[model samples]
Target: MRHRFGRRVCITVISVGALLSSPAVPAVAEGAVPASAANGSGPGYSDDATLRGKIISRLQHMTVQEKVGQLFVVEVYGQDASTVSPTMAARNRALYGVDTPAQVIDKYKPGGVIYFDSRRGPDNVQDPRQIATLSNGLQTAALSQRQPIPLLISTDQEGGAVVFRLVAPATAMPGNMALGAGRSVTDAHRSAEVIGTELAAVGINQNYAPVADVNVNPANPVIGVRSVGEDPELVSNMVAAQVNGYHDGGVATVAKHFPGHGDTATDSHFGLPEVTHTREQLEAIDLPPFRAAIAQGVDTIMTAHVVLRSVDPSGAPATMSQPILTGLLREEMGYDGLIVTDALDMQGATSTYPPNVAPVEAFKAGADQLVLAPQMDVAYTAVLDAVGSGEISMRRLDESVYRILRLKMTRGLFKDPFVNVELAAKVVGASDHLRDEQLITDHTTTLVKNDSDVLPLTRDPQRVLVTGWGVTTTTTLGNAIGRRGQTVTVLETGTTPSQTRINQVVADAAHSDLVVVSTMNAASVNPITGLPTASAAAQQALVKALLATGKPVVVSGMRNPYDISYFTEAPTYLATYGYTAASMESLTRVLFGEVNPVGKLPVTIPHANGSGALYPFGHGLRYDG
Candidate 1:
């Protein structure tokens, strides 16, 4: 769901902070799946007379305005242990409502609300007590409404890079691509269950996760590492396992960027990206994983902002395209679950429709929720106006609300909407959960290329110079090297280093016994390679100069694995795939010969051009080999 382009779009890495520790699921038995798993006419729920009766009854008492309100799942700020703080007051007003969060909750009566990690810091419970209180307060306000309904609290707790939303000491599970490298469906299942369980504990029930996008295009700026892998079948199988894990663990799972966001050069956040795939192409490449997610009984399918040229000829992004969201997804695919649009604040959506009209357009196009409608008041008013004018029929408005209510009901929100603060504090970042996450890290770190067998360092070289051009925090990677008792000089060649910095690194390496270059492009987009600028020069120069030292350098692409082709001169190359502490732990263990590297590349590391990958999807090298 992240589209910030160059900004580090990940909330992974770091530690448990001042929190306790904790805590994935089992398999699918035929009718054993939850009856409320799918909203409408889903497998075992069709004959649930009580569920149907409740929905019909609720519809009769609801007003058009109330029904319209249910279609929105807006974003709100501030965490409340008991009362809102003075410091949070300013942001609360700017983001949530005219006054307090409760006022916004009572006025909008949005069916759900999502929380994102503050652009502020690490993903930890700024205060677990505060969030638990906030959840209870929001639910309290929902019940206070005339037409009372429980709020479906949601967030992007998708693990890996996007773990930003949950600030509790929750375990940062490896991203989807990392789990894919583990090459086990069980790992995928466990990862999701762990994530879902923790999210549920925090009172955020719906996870906008298990990205179903197929990373077919190597140059794809957005979906590259977020997706499971480039191959459709592997991505489908792995994601489907994760879906079951989420459901079994008690949180609703969302299969995102529906119809797929892969294969595009432009990021939808910056501008709309067009998917020129014909029906056959889409069905074969981009659509299968979503097809798998639907079959797996996911609670919601989030629409992509990208336009499917073959499906919607109007060039409208799929979030507002009836042809894609309604026609292709609902009618053709036979998916009865809810459809939620990606955040409307992104330019992909803003570029196509007026801010106030996007929700109405998406609703008419058949989306159940208008996610992160930043102009919440405008979006809400427009939808309400459309309903009154019959531009959006009462029947349509009722359908979405019915689905939203059904979702709340299915999740048992009506019965117990509030979360226990004490339980959440312990459950959010419980120690055992962190261990399981470490187990996942055990299997997901891949070594893409270890040329001339320079890995597994065999010899404990005394002096090691570890540096890289794009490194962010060198402490973890540096500390790992230092743990070997080697005097490690960690040189961070920030974003793009200067020639002087590279020369200094080389100068330092001359007297060193070994040179271990740690690269960190671990974020979403590599501004240097992702953009054409002077920075690219610094990046290339740094690596070239290091190689000129004629030292046996171990180049680890701490972020993008493709740094291999760029640093082909190095005798050894590895793809940590992330710069998180867990990733660094995996890399360090392999370097010190503690743990054998066994991860496979989840996505193909393509060459400079978008033609082919330097390392194919399944490529990897193990230390044991």
Candidate 2:
């Protein structure tokens, strides 16, 4: 295994222009020959030669079209093929020859592929083993067509509400906020190792995680619970530890939403968000974690579509800004690993730049990969034209390609690109999964308030009313409560519930002895501003109703702890750190007095009037009585 600093030096020297401008390609002296003459036996073509050589030689032979295709990452929801329209399929086939996994692999040959939770097996049969089998099968089919360069398989397994390991046998880890509560870098490292080990078992080499953004803005819509915490230095340490953990487990990590999305009030998924901060301020607060990750040799950095006017005065977002990507991240911060643009389909990038031009601009701006292009042909062609026309040098393309190949080589992708289905099945659902889940559950339960000795809900409560938005029949919290109490009523609210639902919740609270209200913000935000709009005034309204009942209202925040201000009057409040099943289960255990809440609040919760009276970064109330 490569030491973190050693890997960083190797990637940086070769990737950051020192070797790009060298008179001779590094492999030429090592006996690299043309592909046709060598019969794949050239110095650069053999497996004996560092895997990097084979990748470089293959890339050297690739036409502009093929090279551009290498930079494009297509989004395939699942093996079903129905999620993508036939028309779109036909278009992909026509443009990049994307049809069967082999055709797509042999034709467009993307550097990576990203999967969502929807790609897992069918509803009833979904399990980590099933996911591993399906993923390995798909990857194998792609490799069988042509000489395979290891395809980077990635997923958003950030744990908590954003878990893909939903089925039985696969364990869920707590979110970053929960890890933050432990206030131990070792805890963060353990969490990363657990997630990395599971993902690696299933052939997922890349995890889009260790959200580097500092959760400074209380109202940040999407990044609340996902962030590690508000302090830049602490987040930096945690991010570094997480990266080290992943690397230790042979899983690549991508520190995301770069240039800092923490202080912004809007979410970038919907539109572009403007970060109104001086360059110095951003450097001090927002960019510290990312800088730390880069310093720790993180494998990749994903750009955010956030506009930082101070950094790039042209109003260009970081995803499309040369100043931010090439100048700041690469030149200033010394990050030479793969630079990936966030999904092109996102409104933040798509709305600003023309569809065909965005990918090209992204490459020119220093991104090595373009994710989820709407039209591969137009995007690929634009990049090819840029390279051929010298708008972006072939050296630049080579630089990016080399770094990507190095990563593949590091992963031993060239030696064995295929996965053993049976072995994967056994490892995917191994005992380690369950153990890690339990550890995270135990670590995330935070006891915010236990005033008046109203905990452990004595034996069984006669009437328990639980109400919250984002809760449903399948919700783990509700199920846990149902198991413990005889009469448990759960009220579900929509994203933004109507007044009628609020009134109904108020009426339901009247007869309940113990009322638990949960609030969640999906963290989806306005793409341009990065601020979140609280959906459903229900949290604010439910507090008033629960206060009227004169009973202990236990308020739990499923998302970010910032929402606690809406229910400050509640005698007992807890922050589960996230909404994952593990979190919910742990929270239930705490509520019923089955477990003590040892975790502290990672982020502060302000007063309802936004007076900044929120619980400070490391505040947790423990019951001594």
Candidate 3:
């Protein structure tokens, strides 16, 4: 039946006991999903208690295997239900005993699927219509099941350094650190809304974003540009704003890598890391943003794989620690929301517990959703066995299943699991979103050092050279500068530029009136030595050579502001924090004095010796003042 949007239709609830004893029944018959799900105007969906009863009724009727399946969100290999290529077909057949996404969904009946733009595998994203069509196809496969439940489609759409899987034609904002640099709560909310809106338009209902980890450690390899800032209070405010923003944009928000993935040198994707901070230190440094997130009623909080030595002396990562997940996050913090593990596929998760064992451990430790299960066959079976063996109590399983159902209901996934494939293109990457993104990016172009007023290039330099580590990044910046009627030359040197490339840039700089050198983590430290790497040495050589040209030089740190300390001899420095096309364009405008740069340092720029701050946090020079 076609339910009109906003109509107050009361859904009658059946007896829970009867539902438990009876054979499972589908929530909605095939080809009969209501329009409320797609339109976000479901009747009585806003009434939490009413939705709770409906979810409980559906939960009681689910089979044991279905309940277990509800806990997993697997990574499928194609943009659509059919396998895209022979390689993907073989991989899917081997992994799930099926060569197509539809067949895999039919067999495993997983609760959700995650999309990724990866180098090693087929990308699950193409354009907006294709993604929306894929989502609809998956939902159609899901609804065809005997006991249907919609999938919670998720992706890491965290704007900055980590590109959202949705790709271009989707609005790409200036990441979390850029928001931190802007230091405006409104900008944070707006940027998140833009991201969430674009994601939702493409039928992705959940985002693993608003990285709540307070990046106190400058040496942090992964979370540096992804995190908002170093201060807990600032991060907290930003996190809360994003939670509200994502909701406003019609997608569930996830505050990730709890209790904190910050303050560590290790990247969880590669190796296991430990946070040895005491309980006092953790509460003061690593947890305020999470607390703020919980307060904002975030839909899910993703567990980190790192061990908190102070909280759980057993040395278990947060994903497998009952003391940390249940005692700390659930009981002490009073957060009753869903706890999801951060990709069981990561080495940090699998290092201690194998792929088959990690999901069971994570569930036992109180995670509701087990994400990115690499070994789906083994992981799914292990969880099922754990439930059947009574090692995982039925009540415990039901608790997680209930949260998963409740999320679907709250998000109106139950009423309408599909998106309008036609409207997706119109909503995603719209003109307004791009404009707002540019405005926010403009606010994030931080002018850190403008010694002797080398900036606001009052005299229009006839010739300009823009050389950077990223090829597209340099091209984008050169294009932007070229639009301003300057003769621009663009050169891209991969992170470690050779001596020949360095000499080429210096020679080119001699011909140009002004040289712009962009560095990508050129000053990143070696984890053990807490000093720069050999790769940093190569990029530094290029920068030092450009500075020696006797011509005016502008060094732009495109990833992190810390690279400025490596080339202090340059007359001027700017921190874009990220190299989104919007960032490059906005940066070009700031260079020509078309817009005044107001972005500040979210994280302090430390001395080359790593002793103290070279430029303290909140330090940004302005063209006007």
- Candidate closest to the true structure, highest TM-score: 3
Q: Which candidate leads in lDDT?
A: 3
The predicted structure with the larger lDDT, 1 or 2, is 1
Model 1 score (lDDT)? 0.73
RMSDs, each prediction?
9.9, 8.5, 7.9
TM-score of each: 0.89, 0.84, 0.92
By summed lDDT, the worst window of 10 consecutive residues in model 2 runs over 19-28
Where does the lowest 10-residue lDDT sum fall in candidate 1?
Answer: 18-27
Q: Write model 3 residue lDDT over 1-625, tens digit each, in one string.
A: 1221112122113222222233433232222222222233322233445565576667656776678788988877787886556877787877776788887788778888888875537577899999998888888898888777899999899987565676688888889899999999999999899989888988999999879999988778878989998989999999999999999999998999899988888998999889978999899989899999987878899999998989999999999999999999888887767789998888998878987789999999989999988777778767766765656766687778777887888898988988998899999999999999998889988999888587887646479999968989999999989888899999888899999888888888888898888998888888888768888889988888888778888999988778978888877999999988988998888999998999999998888887889999999988778
Candidate 2 lDDT over residue span 323-371, tens digit each = 9998998788766677889888788888978877999888889899998
Candidate 2, 133: how far from true, in Å?
A: 3.9
Off by over 4 Å in 3: 1-48, 118-120, 459-461
Report the lDDT of model 1 for residue 200: 79
Error of 3 at 121 (Å): 2.0
Ranking of predictions according to TM-score? 3, 1, 2
Which pairs of residues have clashing backbones in candidate 3?
none
**How well does candidate 3 match the true structure, expressed as C-alpha RMSD?**
7.9
